[model samples]
Target: MIRMIIPLAIFLGLVALLLVSLETAEQRKLVASPLIGRPVPNFTLPGLHDPDVQRSSADLQGEPYIINVWGSWCWACREEHPYIERLGNESGIPLVGFNWKDERQDALRWLNQFGDAWTFHMVDFEGRAAIDLGVYGAPETFLVDHEGIIRHKHIGPVDQTVFEDLMRRIMEMRSEAES
Candidate 1:
């Protein structure tokens, strides 16, 4: 009857909508950060390896660099470590390792086991600076341009495709600076 058909049609439509949403879930995970195009948040955090030494945003102002927010406890950060290592060694861009909300010893242990790839390693034991930078979670990367403006943000793990995209963007930024 028409009544039976109407119920079936509604159920099928709901299922289809759910399927579409599931299909695009990965794409949806990459929500653009509001900090894009804005200057890097100012912070003076101590070095991870040596707390006595301090690094600040002001010091990184003249060069394009990457700020990778990660914690020793994050499994996703482990998954992305190789790609981050590649970025640091091959990208020709300085990478600032922002160790967020982690115990100093654990962060150092993780780096020692995995190999440190950062141009500078800074610690944010309380994550206050990360809050200013709009960090949602670990493994977030922000690419800052030469003038210290944030040009791109990648949420979650950086795999091969993401690495390629970041490399391309870095190249573009360099060319833009040259002109």
Candidate 2:
């Protein structure tokens, strides 16, 4: 009888874990980034449009900005590009496009076809910089404050809801600084 009860208890515990996971599915999608409140990883990568030109983390100091990690091959990146364009056109914040593990020509073509919204673009062909940034996949975004510290990170495509959230965070940051 005791042996039978042990197996029954294990099955019930597994069911409970599954129930909790199912209940928090949406929350799980927003996987927290460890880089929050830390400095942006140092990297100097070539510009997507012009490989001879290089952009570095050091150059982005003294202003709040967004660093969007994307690849031409990522469908989610395509989904989020419109919102990113909106931010670049309206937010008054510089948007840095970090192209990871992609072919340079393909990246340029994608921007040309999709409408370039980034203030500038950097290419990480080998994905070395991405490792430092703790990248899990494409379409990740980082919000960096004026002091070059990463304030927030979103792990997936920035849909309309996520866009609003990002805008709200930017506004809050600005207001906090002004006071």
Candidate 3:
């Protein structure tokens, strides 16, 4: 009878542990990227509108800007597209785009259909630059400072709250730079 009770206790303990783990997993959020506070990765990709025009991390220096990683095929990008357009227009922040792993024509058409929010778009056709940037998926955004350092990374769509947070961080970075 004692031996049978021990087995039952062990089974109950295992069930409790599994239940706790499941609950924790449901509450988990996306982890913050370690690349925050680091320099932007080196990359040169062609412009989406004009392949002959290449943009690089070097060219993005001397100004605070937002690099939005998107794809024509990404539905989440569509959801965030209008907000991004508003962000560029309202904040006066230069919104650069990294068109990740997408066809140039499809991207162009999508932009034409949705309205262009990007000040300029870089074509990451082969996704090499996206890989270097540690991109997990489309619709990620990185806030880069005037010195070309990555200050913040947002893993999902940039809604009003996210944009507000981004602006706050940008202002903080600017103040830090001035001081």
Candidate 4:
């Protein structure tokens, strides 16, 4: 009937308008990235190696440091563990670890089996705290400065080349700041 067609046509038109609007209009979203010079989200979470203790973001103060978020559940983390060890052992900057959402026993076991490359590793169980820090996955590293500000972020496995570049940049930045 004519009446039925009018309502159907109106519904179709509204649907089409919605589709077109969505195509043309960008959705508002908070994009998290570390290009440079942004204050890192501060946190104090339980330590994996020490449950009764907490690792304070404030402790990262007074020195430029490398903070890596990782877990035994992540494959890339397994691949990158040795390199992380290298960085922790050799890098001029202080190295810290955030052992993300993982089994407590497994985390402790992993560090025991492989090595505790971190100065002190924070145990982030359930990943709620890591989510607040904008963590998408394991093996992500944030380079922070003496002021506890995030200077840079690396999203994947970092090799010597990447490490070299970032360290070079941080050194340059530090030199500039001190002068």
Candidate 5:
């Protein structure tokens, strides 16, 4: 009887440990952020505003730029639209958008209703490009240096404070490069 109880207790402990391990693995997937201080991905997709303008990962190069992944279907995108305006207008970082998993017509309409703050918008109909960028959801912002290396990533809406802080950090990077 004593042996039976000890074995059962050991089994229960193993089960609890397994459950914890599984939960931790799942959380890692959801919380996995982009690998900054690395080269940004390279690819070209159709532009939302202009078909002639080739929006590519290479565009992220040659300037301190901001790549914002957004879709009309994403509620967070709508919430963060205004701050994107601040980035384009205030910070002057060639802001661009990845229109992930969105219909062309709906995207255009949404932009028209809100505001086309993006210097350029990529029409990512399938979200393949987004997967390559390690995007978990819309409204994720990446800061790339002039060399096209990702410096930082911000998840969720960008408010005034967030925008300012990012801008400051980007400016610091510029100064550091100059020095």
Candidate 6:
């Protein structure tokens, strides 16, 4: 009876430790990306609106922009769509969308339904660009500076708080660049 109780207690302790670790990881707002502080990956994907038109990292170099990875199948993208639209409208910032592994028609329909917030949507049907950016899933965003360096990355949906934080960072970066 004593041996059985000890073994049960050990098992419970291990389970508790695992749960704690997982909870701590989940609480983190951003997952560190290897590409941070590096140049944006070089890849030209077709435009979501017009497949014949393409945009590459070179096109995004003139100004600071946010590259938001999303898909029609991503529920979190839907949840965050309004805030993204607001960010684009209110801030007048260039917001680019990387449509990851999604059907072009579905992506267009989704954007049409939710309201298009992106200045230009890059269609990444094969997810090759996403892979280069170290994307784990949809709804991840990368804040690229004017020189095309990836300054920060947000792993989840961008909410009001996240948007504010990003704005603050961008302002700081701009100020630093000017000075």
Top candidate on TM-score is 1
Q: Which lDDT values do the candidates have, in the order given?
A: 0.91, 0.90, 0.86, 0.78, 0.82, 0.86
**Residue by residue across 49-119, what tens digits does model 6's lDDT show?**
88999888887786788888999999999988888887677655588888999998899889889999788
The residue-level lDDT of candidate 6 at 170 comes to: 71
Q: Pick the candidate with the highest lDDT.
A: 1
Stretches > 4 Å off in candidate 4: 1-36, 173-179
Candidate 1 lDDT (Cα, 0 to 1) = 0.91
Task: Indicate the worst ten consecutive residues by lDDT in candidate 2.
Answer: 170-179
**TM-score for model 2?**
0.87
Q: What TM-score, over all chains together, does every model reach?
A: 0.88, 0.87, 0.84, 0.74, 0.78, 0.84
Clashing pairs in 1: none
Point out the higher-scoring one by TM-score: 1 or 5.
1
Record all residue pairs in model 6 with backbone atoms less than 3 Å apart, i.e. clashing: none
For model 6, the run of ten residues with the poorest summed lDDT:
170-179
lDDT of 1 by residue, 39-141 (tens): 9889999998889999899899877889998999999999999999999998888999999999998998999999999998889988898889999889899
Task: Encode model 3's per-residue lDDT on 22-92: one tens digit a residue.
Answer: 88884466666778889999998889888998788998888788899999899999998888888778655
Model with the higher lDDT, candidate 2 or 5: 2
lDDT string for model 4 (137-168, tens) is: 77888888877777777777778787787677
Candidate 2: which stretches are off by over 4 Å?
Answer: 1-14, 177-179
Worst 10 residues of 5 by lDDT: 26-35
Clashes of each: 0, 0, 0, 1, 0, 0
Better of 2 and 4 by TM-score: 2
